[model samples]
Target: MGKKEILVVDDQPGIRMLLTEIFTSQGYRVTTAETGQEALDSLYAGSFDLLMLHYKLPVVDGVQVLEQLEKDQFTIPAIVMSGLSEDIMKESQQFEIVKEVLAKPFNVEEVCEFTRSILE
Candidate 1:
């Protein structure tokens, strides 16, 4: 099979860069979006194996993006990241596409492992 494709969406440039570099190094095709609209555009533009998203973002938050996609009936698997309290995390998981939630301080290794765990 071809390399798995991952769409990494985060408002922070550093996080986007880090995930892009880490996943690229692991032989995954990675794309990034700084906003929810860009993320949805990317989703429509390609067939990605997984979506790695940040819950908090500028102009249409992550939950709204996920909800909208779900409303449109896209079954893309997703991994959401957030620094908020655990209660918010619990609340965010109501979306069916959210297969995993990673806290803000997660390491690159954890991200890699989690991605493989889901996609493999």
Candidate 2:
């Protein structure tokens, strides 16, 4: 099989760069966007094995993106990342495609392992 693909959305350049480097090292094909609109555009232009996003995104929040994905009938699996409290994180669990909600300040190893598990 070809390398699994991932669309990672985060507004911070440093975080985006970090994730790109990490996922690339893990042998995954990764694309990134700084805004939910850009993510949606990318989604329209291509398909990915998974979607990883931050809850507090610019233009459109993560929840809105999930709503849009649902409306468009895209059921790809997703991982939501945020520094918000667990109670707040629980909100994103409502989406069927969102398989994980990772709290921020998470270990890179954990993230890598989680992605590997999902892509497998």
Candidate 3:
């Protein structure tokens, strides 16, 4: 079987590059998008086993992107990452499809392990 594919969506180029490098080194297929719209476009073009999304995004916010994905019936698991406060986390957790939320400055290994656990 092929390696699992992960889509990393973040407005920051540094974050995107970091995730791309981390996942690639771990033998997973990694794709990236700098904005929510770009991420959505990438999703429409191909299949991905998971998504790592930054909460605050350009063009469309991460929550909006998640809503759209739900509307479109794309059930891929997602991990939402943000530096937001507890209230935001509570609100985002209302979405059933969202598996987890990781705060910013999180350990890269934790993120990778979470992804692996869910995808496996």
The root-mean-square deviation over C-alpha atoms between each candidate and the true structure, in angstroms, is 1.0, 1.0, 1.0
Q: Give one digit per residue, the lDDT tens place, for model 2 in 23-70.
A: 998888999999999999999899999998888899998889999998
Question: Which candidate do you rate higher for lDDT, 2 or 3?
Answer: 3
Top candidate on lDDT is 1
Residue 53's lDDT in candidate 2: 89
lDDT of all the models against the reference? Answer: 0.90, 0.88, 0.90
Cα deviation at 34, candidate 3, in Å, is 0.5
63 Cα displacement, candidate 1 (Å)? 0.7
The TM-score obtained by model 3 is: 0.95
Report lDDT (Cα) of residue 97, candidate 1. Answer: 88
lDDT of 1 at 64: 88
Better of 1 and 2 by lDDT: 1
Checking candidate 1 for backbone clashes, the offending pairs are none
